[model samples]
Target chain A: MRADGVLGMLDRWGRSALPGATLLFFVLLTLAPLRAPYLSGALPLLPALVVFQFSLATPERLPGPLLLIMGILLDLLLGGPGAPVGVSALGFVLIRAAVVNNRRYLVGVPFLFQWFGFCLLALGFVALVWFFTALWTWTAIDPLPALMQYAVVIVIYPLLAPLLARVRARDPLNVPDASRGTARPGETTS
Target chain B: MAIRDDFEVVASQVRTAVQRFALGLLVIAAFGAMLLGKADTVLVEHARVLALDLASPVLEAIARPVAAANRVIADLKEFASLREENARLREENVRLLAWQTAARRLENENERMRGLANFREGPEASFITARIVGDSVSAYVRGALLNVGRKAGVASGQAVVTGEGLAGRIAEVGENRARVLFVTDVNSRLPVVIERTRERAILAGDNSPQLRLTLLQSVAGVQRGDRIVTSGHGGSFPVGIPVGEVVETGEGSVRVRPFADFSRLEFVRVVDYGVTGLVGSGGPAAPAAPPAGVRVR
Candidate 1:
């Protein structure tokens, strides 16, 4: 293969592979030593890591059904009570699909919107898992603690979003050509 | 040309259908695994143990430094008030000595009563001290793993307590460590009787700091300030240990405030109930004999 072809293949592979690897990193982070048992902070939103990666790199690579499968796999790996990751990933895919075309929304929106979106998805995800687990285990777990954890995630997003941006590609919102010229408000045509 | 072009369009459509069908199968399998995992059969247990074992070293490496720093900070915090603390301790020591004298007299009277009642034997007990190595990973359960295990004379069903009162029981034991299910864990249920009133009830933890007292035959005699003690009816925990104080919630429900402080859990004494001899064969169980400096009487 030509050098560009080799580089292109590598780029394609990296785009496809990096998200899964990062999710695994988050898994390990949950497995990291802290006050809480089980890396719950890392586990619940793991599907977001996968979804965000796919949306940024290859927006339509994973079909809706495939995204559902990815979520299911994440759910099992996370070892929670139910399809939290599955349901959340599907939610992300739907959101991404809905927003990908609206250049104005994607580019015009502030990072805070993204952060809030993540927060809502996380809250919904934890609630789903807690509900199913409580039903199956025949035990009621208070949602208050999980909500407290979600609050922590929301607080940390500013730090995390910038870091993830550096590690991955530039914000698709920033690059009109990159995200199919969908740059939103306050962005230059360049 | 017409036939060939028709087949090409249909070929892609069929392939898409097959791919979608396979994806459906994958989702079902993954979801099935989650539901089926509830059984907690030997396979799941083994996987959890293996995962924990693999993950323990990493957790320990992180927890060790955090625990050490916490201890140092605690020491520094205590240093600021050491003079006042010492003064209080000295005064408390004198009071405790007087209390001890009375306690000894009561013990003698209790022994006399037991003899009068013709009780065949006293409770056989041995204990080993261990350190809390880690905490449970789930929010739904309150638990801790201790460093001592079957190799160190630690066994399942052993009562883990502090000097003050009942802590919990040894749920699962491994070669060198054991998992202790706290008295505050959701699954914990122990036979208990209110110390002041002798009202029997089940002490159960529902992932709360206070354990609920359920199935009480009568609340007439049980009060908010009543002391709760292990009934030892279940043959797990030894009888007469201070468990908690009864806290009466509204609507006839009550819970016990556990005596042990779980947040700063440092050391625990694991009691080995020599039940094999005391209940059955009538011989000294394990440890051969009690260690010196510790007198049963």
Candidate 2:
């Protein structure tokens, strides 16, 4: 009985850690040297997508600290010589804050509505990073690349959303609205 | 049951408060890190190098299959253009053969003059070929992470190049990985000379595809198609390494397009010319003496 209990505890812990692990995988994926010009530029958006999806779907699984760590890892990996560290971390934190603040409006919304919300959030995120980077570098950086990044993120969101939803559904502890300690009209604890 | 419900509500409220507090702290911490990094602190560089060393192996492992797939795609592309490419190469080879003869004649004359002047030769450059395992994800930064480092004798300030021309210079070196700050990075600055006019200038990257030629003494002599090569002023890079060519000569802002394609870099040779007067923050370790019988020009 004790062994079974320990196994169950381990399984629960693993399930809880899945979202963070997925984020980490996306972080590494972003850093992979794809060598294709457009794909290389578009890869950085993967982690942001994961952060947004998890923040809205399961904020508790991906807490602030995990996002902080993921952001730092990205900054370190992507921060070249004289590039400011923690800018990515800052971006990730702001993304989570924006999503969590509007979670009530976004959680049960239609997919198109959620995607529209993401477009605004992503634009804001890109602009924030661009502004902070320009301030840090003290130069008028070109805005075209940032805009391109935003476009790619917006285009990719709807396609990646269903995949993220599937991953969330497979989580053993993800009991719809039950673990959130609140149930909507349509969602009920099994 | 009423007491339990009240306790649960209080606990949830406390949790929410804690999360908000933690988020605020993380934002502040990130700002602190950015400031610390901008200050160019050694602590931050060391931490970055440590992170790079830890992550390089996994990145390298992941890059292999992608590289293979890329190669296959490249092969298909090449096959499609094989006829035109072959015709162009054949024409180019014939032209190069004539240039090769002239180059050989000039080499003989230069050698004779050097012997007559008893010119001292600099140490021959050694190369360490490294595979590019990763690249900067942020558009703000222009750099690449190479899969060679201190273990492979890749020190900071070595000139990284491709067969075409100078790509960039080594910025940070770790135990098993190193970062190359591309010539198009905002932080990169190199002294170069216009080949046609011999006018010197500072080649600066503004995080754009084309590098800006700043600090030029004579912009009047600059024109389109002027070749820019390193002047070897800072002792960080060797003399006469091809950097780029003047593509645009706008008013007060000249743009030079780099010869080495930063987007498609796969393998780069890190050249150690034994000159170690790197000019930047956290400069390379104390300059090693030129080996016996070898003198820096």
Candidate 3:
């Protein structure tokens, strides 16, 4: 029974290994140099996609602790003026938990709820985290531009979300095993 | 049976708590690493250097093809609008032709009288041209990397200029890549002289397009349309390089309209101001030019 809890968490996330590939894609893309000579205020949010993936499929896998670590790693790796990753990651955790825990009301709902929720969560995470951390770093006054740039991330979300959903559907881990006595509730198969 | 269930629940709670504590420590550790690297740490510097080195090749590989594709798309779009573009170009050409005539006359006159003036007294500067291959990926940073670096005979403190005027100076140097801290960065400061009055002031940027001239004791002496030039106070930049023109703002602070077009910087010159003076290996005396006895009548 004890093994089941740990194994259940693994089984849930292990289903869509696509998040791992997506994370790598984003990190490399972010680390990769731009092909132009002008600055781009827009940044592709690979981490936010990770949040959405786990939120929709395996909420238990993306625990509070992992989100926090991912956030810190982001801050360190990106090395922005402020430590924004921490709060953003926390936002992801809270948003995911709220949506998953309240999945009953949202059941049988169309994709719009998921899309809108993810955008708000991602934007709010970027804004709140960037706003506060920037304040700490004495550069907090520039929130307007940050918000505008985050809107770009939101605009690109709907397009990216469905593709991720398709990838998640094809994962073998998402396949239901009826023989595992009393399949856990709310685990969607198909 | 009840006691056994209680024990299991307590054990799981402890495990969760332990995991949380470890994560907390990791967060603190990351913060510590940032603070430790506040000023000149090898690890942070090494990582930055490695990132630049790694990204440059990627940038170089993609830059040409992307630019070419953009050009092709632009050409296709312009084909539908060529008639309008042609009219604009013709008008621009007429204006440029008039300016070209005046420019040619000035150049001839200046060259004829150049031998008699201070032209022979100043140290000559030479530069290597480089292309801007990549832009700052991080939003807070106001700089870009060029393919030229220390290994390419580039050095720190070398001033980079576009065709219009001074762009910025090389801040960091890796093997094949160097970062240029633009004049619009908060930390950037340049000693500039107003060409009209020869009044010296420090031009500083706060990551804004409008750069302020600091330490202006008498605002009355400075006026709009005054040309700014490098004062050569810090020796980082060459004297008389065109900086920008002054514009008076309503806030009572003077802003400079940068001569270089930051929006469309493509090719730049890396002024390799010879480091002979810095390294104590002063080169041989400047090559003597036969005295130009020509005097302007």
Candidate 4:
């Protein structure tokens, strides 16, 4: 019975493994207080890039609440009165909404167009951040920090794209190979 | 078959709508947490501690090799400049010796004065030095994480200083790690006095390189070269730690350039000193508890 249960759990894990792993990896990266600067304060939005990639192509895979939780974790690490978390979570939801709506235009597009689209998404992210910061401090501290973050994200996303693509490809491809000839009685097997 | 297809279509629609509804709820919850946190900081402080305790262990483990590599790189760089650094330090040592002699005379005078006044003795402050593991990711508020935590008896509001001068204070502590709120962070407000004129002012951080000195008694006498140190009005930092210098003083405005190089910080000593009059203060390290409803926000 225990073996059957373990096997069942494995099967469930198998079906959505790649997207799950990708999301988990990025969320942890977001939570981790890891800072490296191409320049001082030029932190790349690693989690944002990951969310943008999957939210368009596979919105079902990267759940909205999971993204919100990631933002909360970010808030906790970022050390504020939770304003960054709300702003970031709102940013994630808007990105998911935008990407989901524009999926048809976005899905099979050239890398350049997707990159341009990501620019728009990142702008929203940056703007939300600046807006909340201004509200909190009652004065806009500095725009350079936010701009640097934008510049670094744009520079880093292309490098991360191929890796994200590889992760996205593995699971869906594996489903067919691993589940070959194991047709369920009622389901039209893919 | 047609009926089954229709049912599947309805099921998928329902699933989509449910997911959308859940997303909306999460967004609302996120905003609520933010708003509530703004209203009450104690909850936010608790959350920060909990999150750090959970994350810092893993971060500490990960940061070990990276920190070691950073040390090696720094050592290599230092080695290349060994002769220049050695000579510079020797010269500075010669300069400080004269100041040290003067300082000893002042110390003796102050002790005699205190004895004449019958001053009550305060608890002696202790120091716990910890290596900074990494810079914080959040741009909202400036912070740096340390490897040693509550396991090392690090607590919030403990002054974190480097060999150079004052760095900041422990804002949040975890089990095996802590986050130092730098002197340049927006939330940092230190009660500081001008070293030359003895004029008192509040040194406030605006998330910039130069800290702002506000609430000044009179900016009229302040000049560019004046030194600044803590007035020790607040019960957090002890009296007379060298904080920074007056870099810019304008009409009704003054800015300080911190003596410590915050950007290049690698390690700092968390000093536990009695700040709050030692009146009804608990044991040595644990800071005096916030009064019934007056915890610093």
* Deviation of model 1 at B67, angstroms: 0.8
DockQ, ranked from best to worst: 2, 4, 3, 1
In model 4, where do residues sit more than 4 Å from their true spots? Answer: A1-40, A81-85, A136-139, A173-190, B1-16, B72-94, B97-122, B149-151, B275-277, B281-297
| Candidate 3 lDDT over residue span A109-152, tens digit each | 57777666766667666666566456545653445555665776
Question: What is residue A78's positional error in candidate 2, in angstroms?
Answer: 0.8
Candidate 3 total steric clashes = 0
Top-TM-score candidate index:
2
Q: Which 10-residue window of candidate 3 chain B scores lowest in summed lDDT?
A: B288-297
- Clashing pairs in model 3? none
The candidate, 2 or 3, that scores higher on DockQ is: 2
List TM-score per model, in order.
0.69, 0.89, 0.73, 0.81
When sorted by TM-score, best at the front, the candidate numbers are: 2, 4, 3, 1
Candidate with the larger TM-score of 3 and 4 = 4
Q: For model 3, how big is the CA root-mean-square deviation?
A: 8.0
- Local error of candidate 4 at residue B119 (angstroms): 6.5
lDDT of 4 by residue, A109-145 (tens): 6888888999999888888878876786577667776
Task: State in Å the error of residue A142, model 3.
Answer: 2.5
Error of 3 at B275 (Å): 3.8
| Candidate that scores best on lDDT | 2
- All DockQ scores: 0.15, 0.65, 0.19, 0.39
* Residue-by-residue lDDT tens digits, candidate 4, B66-152: 556656766787899999999999999999999999999999999999999999864677677777765774455677888777666
